[model samples]
Target chain A: MRLGRRFVIAVPTLWLLLFFMVPFLVVLKISLAEPRIAIPPYSPLWEWVNGSLKFNINLENYSYMWEDSLYLNAYLSSIKIAAIATLLTLLAGYPMAYYIARSPEPRRSILLLLVVLPFWTSFLLRVYAWIGILKTNGILNAVLLWAGIIDEPLVIMQTDVAVYIGIVYTYLPFLILPLYANLVKLDDTLLEASRDLGASRMSSFFRITLPLSMPGIIAGSMLVFIPVLGEYVIPALLGGPDTLMIGKVLWNEYFSNRDWPVASAVAIVMLVIMMIPIMILRRAQARGAEI
Target chain B: MSEHILAAETKPWVKGTDRPFVRIKGITKMFGDLAAVKDVSLDIYRGELFCLLGGSGCGKSTLLRMLAGFETPTGGAIEIDGQDMTGVPANMRPTNMMFQSYALFPHMSVEKNVAYGLRREGVPKGEAMQRTADMLGLVKLDGFARRKPHQLSGGQQQRVALARALVKQPKLLLLDEPLGALDKKLREETQFELIRIQEELGVTFIVVTHDQEEAMTLSTRIGVMDAGRIVQVGEPREIYETPNSRFVADFIGSVNIFDGEVDVAAPDLMRVNTSEGPVMCEPVAGLTARQKLHIAVRPERIRLSRTPLEAANTMQGVVTEVAYMGNLSVYRVQLPNGQCLKVTAANGLHEDNPITWDETVHIGWSAAACRVLVK
Candidate 1:
């Protein structure tokens, strides 16, 4: 019995140690080091000098990030974009989740399957496909132009709007799945009780269903917000030159400038910035369990 | 407000002077081809605690749901307080329901839950707060107003649900298995608490439960349903003592029933020839001499002794098994013809007079004690 219990506990511990803790420690060590023109491109933490041990820890990377306004602007812009994208996803996904949750048996399963069906394709390919549909000469513009809806080709191909579309389209399932799970577990009698207590349908939704589904909302928002904060691909591919994100800046520092230390510093700061919402999501989940 | 809408007197059902507070006329609900509630009609008077009693899936809950407007009747009309309820949504209706699961809002405090309806009605904050506090006090949850539903025990949550439902002062209060979630001890106590509150408030209540004992203790009138139809509806004593059908007699309590045909029918008595022997039953109106029927008798009414007593019905049987309860002892006596019967005898305080197992004994009852069920 003891051996079996230990084995069950050891599996997840070992998995996290190997995959998560080690990689994070590596990044932390690199963030504290100085850039060098070498194979690994960063100075080691310690070196043998004058037959004794000597330390070479650099705080210059972090100070450089603080001195420049580029990093601060990128972080703020990323938060703004991520917050707006999350709001849009919520507005679109809540109704879909409620519809699926309220739908009767086989139809409910079919709707849930449709929500997750887009995930079967490659994420990158799906984002790339958004480009094909949203560009100036793409299907959307062609159809709108043919229908006399627009006299000129709308410049929506390379913009923040296109980026929002890509993020919501890609991460929609994340929001819907959790919200559906939460809404499905919500007892129908609670809604009935609300209605029976003289609440209008809209009032019932706002009072009962919305408050009960807060855990799902916070969880999905954190899942989308943290990833979209340091997201490099969608903004880099679809956003114009004015669109500056921390992930793109980090990438440019690592590959173009060969500055692994500064890149690691930027990555660490992004992680710190994302931790606040993730902690909030965790507290919400804890409270949900109590409920 | 609800009192103004209600008619006068507590036992209005007995006088038959005022119109029924709730009139369900031929209400039927169908789920595809199967009918959950098929043409059920009943009248509930003001200040009456009526119970819809049935086994599971017998449509008692469905009938209550229809009254609450949770499920619209497919082919009938309901008139509550002299107004037609067709096309009236659950929110618009002047009825509130206490669900079996209690359905307390897990996110809100007890005070907030009780105040929710009044807030929706746009009551002033001070008035709503006063009413909410009064309701919480009525349900004996005055100190736990700020606690959420999960923070309290099951019984406390149930009280919160009741306070929330009653704070609206609805014309009709529908409860679906209110005590089904509680344990035996709490259920018995809550049953009387429920009665006290109903009588004090003088509101018409329709409670749905499968427990016959609960129905007997809580309701002024009980409607026994079977197969999506109400088989019988009457006062508790009337339903128990003079059931019109075999289903109601068997469903209500422990009963020993014997199938038989009427050999002779007289004004005061009827002789039934059963597989065991000829049994005596009370004469029921419209029962023919040769009509096939069943003789039903309660166990406590039957007498068991070493010698036969002077009664209209008597049978000789051997006591096969005996179960000694504290107050009463149950005897499983088998007749010579291979039929077993349950007979219970209360243990007298200073008596050692119980026929042992495997002994020849006689069971007899008066003709009036056994009912004659034709169908």
Candidate 2:
């Protein structure tokens, strides 16, 4: 039985080592090498010198990332934007998930389907559609003008606000789905027990419902924050030039600047920065499972 | 008439001077087109362990929820401790419920779950902690206070739920099938523990349960419900011995009911002409001659003997089934009229010479043992 279980686990372990670990090793190796003007665009980690192998590791790429204000600002702004977007998504998704979870069984499935309906269209198409809605002469401005709510067109497109809107809209289902699963599993009688014990509706929600759904909050926040930290398409399509993000900088370096070594360094550093939350999420999930 | 009046008035708790602590007046709860709890009125006195006993979908739980203020009555009013509870929210009500599932907060420790009510009442933290400790000690769960609910055993979790509900010191404590989750042995043990805590705290308790034995053991008075209506409300022994209807008799315990007509309805004694034979029973007032009625006799009340006895209500029957329970032996006696009557005999020192199946037996019961149901 143990051997059969080991065999069952071995397949996925081998696949992950080959597909994920190997690529990560390659990226790490490239990040330690110097950028070149050749086709491959980066120097090899080891080279033949006088018929003997000599290592050519470069620390300049790492130091250059620290020296540049653009890279530092991009990292900080990416973190800030992702954090804000995650918070917004949580604020919007919690009530949606709670309502769906509390709804009658027949309506619950339909509400969940509505949450996931946006995924039927391509993510890029949805982000592109935001452009038509948020632009100065777009649908939102046209509606506001027609309604007499505003006289001037709103300058929302190609701004930080647009990026935030796009991120929240795109990742809302990811947040709501996990939260819904968690909230639906909550025993209704626990809330009643709280109320029965003299807790008002608000206090019961905070003390019982909120604390019980912490695992879901952590899971959902990580789902939104990790992806938004590396979000490229939403910012590229909706954000202005002033809206600096690490994903956009990495894209410019690898694709436009053709600096694969510096881009690899950026990718490695992003991974390191994301490692903290990922570990925290994993620990929380483990603890939740134990409970 | 005098015996009836004495029986009604002699119950010490039902005196004229005693006012009910909780009065539910003509309360009706309707769910869409369905009346889950019909027009029902009941009075429960202070410090009484009252049980709402019924089967599933019989509205006992609905009545308990109405008492907890979780469900509002479509009509009628509730007054607790002389205060109107109409439209009062569950949080605002002076009552707490221990849920059937024991709904202890999974995220909190036992201490926190117990202290949650006091915390919500804005009690001081130190005082709340002290009360929580005292409640845990009352339930004998003091050492397990720091552990989360999932970490405790089922019985321990039930105790925690009890402690949590009781710590608020609410005027009324509602328990919905509190022992339903425990195994048989644990359930029996916890039933007494619950009664002990209830008495010690002097809290008025309204427990809802479908388990008749649980109700019998725990309740000072039981309100038997059926199909959204309360059929009878009395002490457990009164309910068992003098059930108002066949439904109450059957619902509470094993009963042998005989459909019959009143052969004679006199002031002193009445006789029922059943399919088996004519049965003489104690007179029930307002029963007229030749009127259709039913006679309910408990299994334990019927006597089983191998030899015939010259008794007023005696029948010769062959024992078809003999179940040798450790404490008692149940015999299914099939009379010549094709009716089967259940009789339970105490299995004392005569275990070796037990009554076997197919043995002809004489079954009899005193006239006082039989309940004459007019409905």
Candidate 3:
């Protein structure tokens, strides 16, 4: 390669190596070590004993994670929750994005601003506020009870329902922003032409609008799904003891249990699990670009 | 009104059916405070390639959209195939439109795009596929069925759009500037292709275009619109040769217009006094002596010569500008009164008649060539 092209390519590759690959290598190294009560809190994978070199690569942490039912349950439930939340976000975001894209001029800009306006406040504070709204005898239940819609105050707080609500409310903007950008570039005439060709309004949307917005849907799904899979914040606050997520498991293993080696093993496994969807979405996006 | 009768007499389709295939009665459309189409009424015969010709925002497109059921008229009615189309949506209407943008579905293959309408109508899959293939063959895009819209050229995309619209075999086909996207040579070919397809299917076609030459060559009749109102409707030849008003004459093609007044009025012959001199023209009804009106003479009708002819409508002018096109030569002759007249003479390769710049010439046209426009 030419010097200029090589230099242009080296920048991002160098940054990724320094920040991502190096840190990941460190985690891999730690995941192979045994727990120690001494200073650094983990036995080294290699060290010189007396004159000769001693090697001790512990596979105990990984074996324990594979054997434990809690870890298995956490991984399964995390995937399910992420998939369901991503779908809910897509269904809720698609219409808002479509409406904003079709709106005229200043109103379009205003609606887009409103979609992103929630980003201005602190995310932690917003999720904390959901606690007040979703708890028993809270605002939602209070309103429902007063309106005679419910016989009792619902036990929504510390449940999967509250967790889903929290995740959707926080991550919805992530989906809408990309979907809106895609929908906005769609030509209005394509839809009109569909109708002109004897397709009804519903038929036109599926045949025209939905297929054209596939790239946006895939992108937004990845943006929400990838992060929600490892999400620790919402579930920790709004979910009960019955809720099983890999993020909370990794957190408990790392901080409360003081088991760095096991935590590193859990982190490496989570990283591997997350990579599968990322690869799939990337391939889908590339195919969409070809079309 | 007489032009309508004149147009109707020459058309076999109009004579075959006493009623028009599509009838628009006082249809008007308003956008906020601005009226886009206003109280325009027209009748289009079956199998006739009708063109709504106008400048930008002259309501030609608005009227076409109303026919396709894309836009609802603010007032009045539209009847197609003897059914009133007041509240019908575009999908349910017996009409299909080819948009000016050639809005081919970017994701779908050409065959799928063509088969979309049939699929919507619950046609059998095998029959829909057959019709799609046939439509593609009709548009000469048989080899391009598997390609996406973006993979095709602009002309090919236009053909795909045409095939997709025509696959359903609509009673009325609305084309919004059908040839506006193609190059001149391609447009000429497609114009005939479109006419051939329309003739083969015997479907009524209504095209909206601003290019007058395209309208003249492609449409059986042209409706000239201006400022939200249709100024006149007639056959292409009638629109060009006997335009009813000054606006129609000026809008259709180049013409030398003179503001004149009636010196004598009769059914057979009339003499009009103009700033240049006295002008004799064919009969113009409802004219009194000394009444004001405009007279128009087409550039091609006028004869240019070095020597003056003993003609009834002859004027002497200096050739200020000369443009020699390959087949014809056009001269802009300036009269003594500062009124300029344009005359086009065909260049016969064998003849040695040459008229040039700064040459004193006499421009003349017969009385029959002159047209009297009331407004």
Candidate 4:
């Protein structure tokens, strides 16, 4: 290759190698190091006290991770919450996407703009805005009390429901954009042909519209489900201690207990657990394209 | 009020046995401020192939859509088998449409697409399959039942669309520019195939097309539309030989038209005075004294000879150009007044001694061959 082309290609590759790959290798190395009481807990380096090479490495961290019941429970809970949230987002996004796709030309642009305008603000700030509304003393409770629907404030704060609401609100645009792309490409004449062929409007939707839009459904579910698996901020703020999410557990191990080896082990397992759906999503996307 | 007038006129025009199968009454459709079909009334009889012929944006497709119940008329009623279908949805109505694009289901097989309507009507699976197979056999697509739409050729796809529509046994079938997407040869072949199918099934068909030849070849009767209103409706021969107006004459076929003034109006015939010369026409309705009229003469009717013929209504002209097709020849003749008229002749023994271009020729037609078009 030419010198200029080599420079253009090699620069970002070198940057990634130094910044991204080096950090992951460092983490992996530290995860395999033995537990020792250094100034920074579980430092991989060993000191020669008796003038001999004092190298110590063990698989105790992996053994502990495998034996711990809490780690297993955290992984299972993460999957369940992400699955439920993905389903909820799909239920909410599908109709909104269809309506946007079916709206008049002038109104379709405005509706799509409104669906995406929430992204102008910071994602963390948006989640915080939801916090203000979903908390026990938030707008939801204030409205219920003012309307005399409830005598007391509802205990919505620091619960899994609030966490789910926070996640769905933040990722709604992600779910809707994909579904809209698929729904808008559908030919309206197909529905008319179906009706002309003696199928009712409702039957046409199920047999034609719904099946043809499955690729969008799978795509939107993946977009919401994958990131929400490792969600920390929403659960940390909204979920009580009783909420034993994997992200929270990993966070506790790394910061409060200062157990670096155990934290690294949990991080590796979480990475592996997250890769399952990613692989499944990749397969679905390939099949969707083929269809 | 109009029905009484139509019925009163119908008694003398056509007998009771020739009653129309489908009657469209005063159907006017308006989209906001624009009128798509304006006070259109037509009678399509049983087992007759009819065509709504026009150019784009002429509301021919809109009229077909209204017949299929895809668009409801702003005023008027559509009746199939003597039953009103004013507010009926397309699914509930006994009418089917063969779309212009042949909107076959991309996911379903041919057999499944044909069986869709029967299944929707709650027919048992075995009966539906039998009917679907029968329909496939009728359309000559029996062996291709397992193929999806995309797997078939354009002509085959059109046949699948036809079979799917006919499987329901609708009272009336509406085809919106059928065979439009096929090649020229395929379109011609499909046109004949469609006519044969309609004949065999004895079903009423209303075909919409912008191609004048397709309409002329396929329709038993045709309604020529312009600017959202039908200008004239008649049998194919009448539409070609005797159009009601200049617009219908020019739209249906190529003709040599002469703008003239009525010189005389007799009981059986009318005389018109044109810049080229005076000509005679068969007497038609809606004529007034000294009114401006258009005279249409078909290219084939004007006989050309090298020598001046001793005949009535003869014109002396020079051959300007000659277009030679394999079996026929068209001579463009320019009269003394600088008016050009076309004369088409079939190649035969006369072609062995044909007239060359730029030769002086005499063109004449019989008086009964021309129609006085009141435009």
Could you tell me the TM-score of candidate 4? 0.90
List the candidate 3 regions with Cα displacement exceeding 4 Å: A1-18, A45-59, B1-17, B263-271, B350-353
Question: All models: lDDT?
Answer: 0.90, 0.92, 0.92, 0.87
For residues B77-146, write the lDDT of model 1, one tens digit per residue.
9999999999999999989999999898899998998999999999999999999999998999888989
lDDT tens string, model 3, A166-263? 99999999999989889999998898888888888988898899999999999999999999999999999999998889999999988898799999
Question: Which lDDT tens digits does candidate 4 get at residues B1-375?
Answer: 988878545442244467678888998999999999999998888887989999999999999999888998999999988889888999998889999988887778889888988998999999999999999999898799898788899999999999999998988999999989999999999999999999888898999999999999998889999988989988788899889889998988889899998888888777889999889877766777778988999999888887777655799999999999868898999999999998898888655678878899888898877877778
RMSD of 2: 2.6
Give each prediction's DockQ, rounded to 2 decimals.
Answer: 0.87, 0.85, 0.76, 0.62
Clashes of each: 0, 0, 0, 1
Clashes by residue pair, model 4: A158-A238
Q: Could you give candidate 3's per-residue lDDT for residues B1-375 as a string of tens digits?
A: 999998668795457556888989999999999999999999888788999999999999999999988899999999998999999999899999999998888888999999999999999999999999999999899889899899999999999999999999999999999999999999999999999999999899999999999999999989999999999998898999999999999999999899989998867789999999889998766789988999999999999888888766889999999998989988999999899999999999877658889999988889989988888
Candidate 4 per-residue C-alpha lDDT over A1-291 given as tens digits, one digit per residue, 9 for 90 to 100: 699999999999999999988887777777777655676678654568678877667678889987989988998899899899899999899999999999989999999999999978887887778778877889999999999999999887788888888878878888999999989988888899999878889999998889878888888888999888888887898777777788898899888988888888887778788788789878877866754
Candidate numbers, best TM-score first, in rank order: 1, 2, 3, 4
| Lowest lDDT block of 10, candidate 1 chain B | B2-11
Task: Please report how far candidate 2 places residue B245 from its true position, in Å.
Answer: 0.5
Alpha-carbon error at B213 in model 4, in Å? 1.4
* Pairs of residues at least 3 apart in sequence or in different chains that clash in candidate 1: none
Q: Where does model 2 exceed 4 Å of error?
A: A1-15, B1-13, B264-269, B350-352
Clashing pairs in 2: none
Q: Which candidate should be chosen as best, given TM-score against the real structure?
A: 1
